[model samples]
Target: MNINLTLIGQSITFLAFVWFCWRFVWPPLLGVMQEREQKIASGLEEAERASKDLELARRKAAEQLKEAKEQAAEIIDGANKRANQIIEEAKNAAEAEGDRLKAAAKAEIEQEVNRAKEQLRSRVATLAVAGAEKILSVNIDAQAHDDLIEKLAAEL
Candidate 1:
């Protein structure tokens, strides 16, 4: 065989192989690479969106926590005020009860004093009648002198 003819045949075969690869195999490979690149870009965008959503959730949770703390403070303040009001009411009720008891005791003491005074007046009238009968040397008829005895007892 001629060396030049063999070299030319080899060169033509190499060219045909290169063209086939470019038309068929290379197109599919390039398509796969572009599809992978697009998928990676979309995944990066989704990750960025998820990060923003997480930040927003954190802010909302912080706001809710602040509102809850404020509501708790308000509830505590209201409870304290109500406790103070109840204490004042109890104190007033106790004072009123004490005053009523004192008044009742004073009235009872006055009634006892009046009863003693009445008993003493009756005893004094009886003693005077006995003395007058002994001095006059006669038994005094108390029933007959009922009006006089009653008048003298009233004066005593």
Candidate 2:
């Protein structure tokens, strides 16, 4: 082969191949590359949005938990106050019962003392009548002296 002719034929074939690839293949490849880049950017944006949502959820849950703890403390305080009120009412009732019992016992003791005094007076009156009859040496009229005996007993 002649060197100059071979060189010219190879150069012409390389230029034609470059032109065909540009017209038929380059536009679609560029479109596919741009589509892939857009998809990757959209995926990154979605991941960032998910991370922010998770953080917000954690904060809200913490707030709810704190509110629940406060409510439990208030319930405990209410129960303690109720228990104290019940104890105070019970103490008052016991004290009232004790005072009532003491009064009843005092009244019973007073009645017993009065009955004993009445028995002693009757006995003393009988003894005085027997002595008077013995000193006079005569039988006394018992029915007639009933009032006098009672008067002497009262004085004694």
Candidate 3:
């Protein structure tokens, strides 16, 4: 056989084999590789979306907690204000009660002093009559001198 002829035959066979693989075997393999690459890209996209959702959830929870704390503070402030109002009301009531008691006690003391003065005036009037009788050494008509004694008691 001729060397050039054998080389030409081998070259033709190699070309035919390469063309067959390119048309049939290579397309399926490239398709499978492309499909696997698309699947991996979609999976990465899903993972990124899940990460964003988790961050959003955390932010919402933090906002809710802050709102709850503010509400609690407001409630505590309201309660403190109400307590102060109640204390002020109690103080005012106590002051009013004390004033009323003082007024009653003052009135009662005035009444007692008036009664004591009345008794002393009557006693002084009786003693004056007895002294007058002794000085005059005469029987004064007691009933007729009643008006004079009353006037003297009033002056004293």
Q: Estimate each model's TM-score.
A: 0.69, 0.56, 0.55
Clash count per candidate? 0, 0, 0
Candidate ordering by lDDT (highest first): 3, 1, 2
TM-score of structure candidate 2: 0.56
| Candidate 1: tens digits of C-alpha lDDT, residues 1-156 | 557888989999999999999999999999999999999999999999999999999999999999999999999999999999999999999999999999999999899888888887778767866766774576557675666667676777
Positional deviation of residue 88's Cα in model 1 after best superposition, in angstroms: 0.5
Measured by TM-score, how close is model 3 to the native structure?
0.55
Q: What's the lDDT for all of these models?
A: 0.88, 0.83, 0.89
lDDT of 3 by residue, 1-156 (tens): 557888989999999999999999999999999999999999999999999999999999999999999999999999999999999999999999999999999999999888888887777867886767774586677775777667776787
State which candidate has the highest TM-score.
Answer: 1
Give the top-scoring candidate (lDDT).
3
Considering TM-score, which of the candidate structures 1 and 2 is the better prediction for this target?
1
Clashing pairs in 2: none
RMSD of each: 5.8, 6.0, 5.7
Clashing pairs in 3: none
Give me the overall lDDT of model 2. Answer: 0.83
* lDDT tens per residue, model 2, 1-156: 557887989899999999998998898999899999999999999999999999999999999999999999999999999999999999999899998898988888888777766776666767776766774477567765676666776777
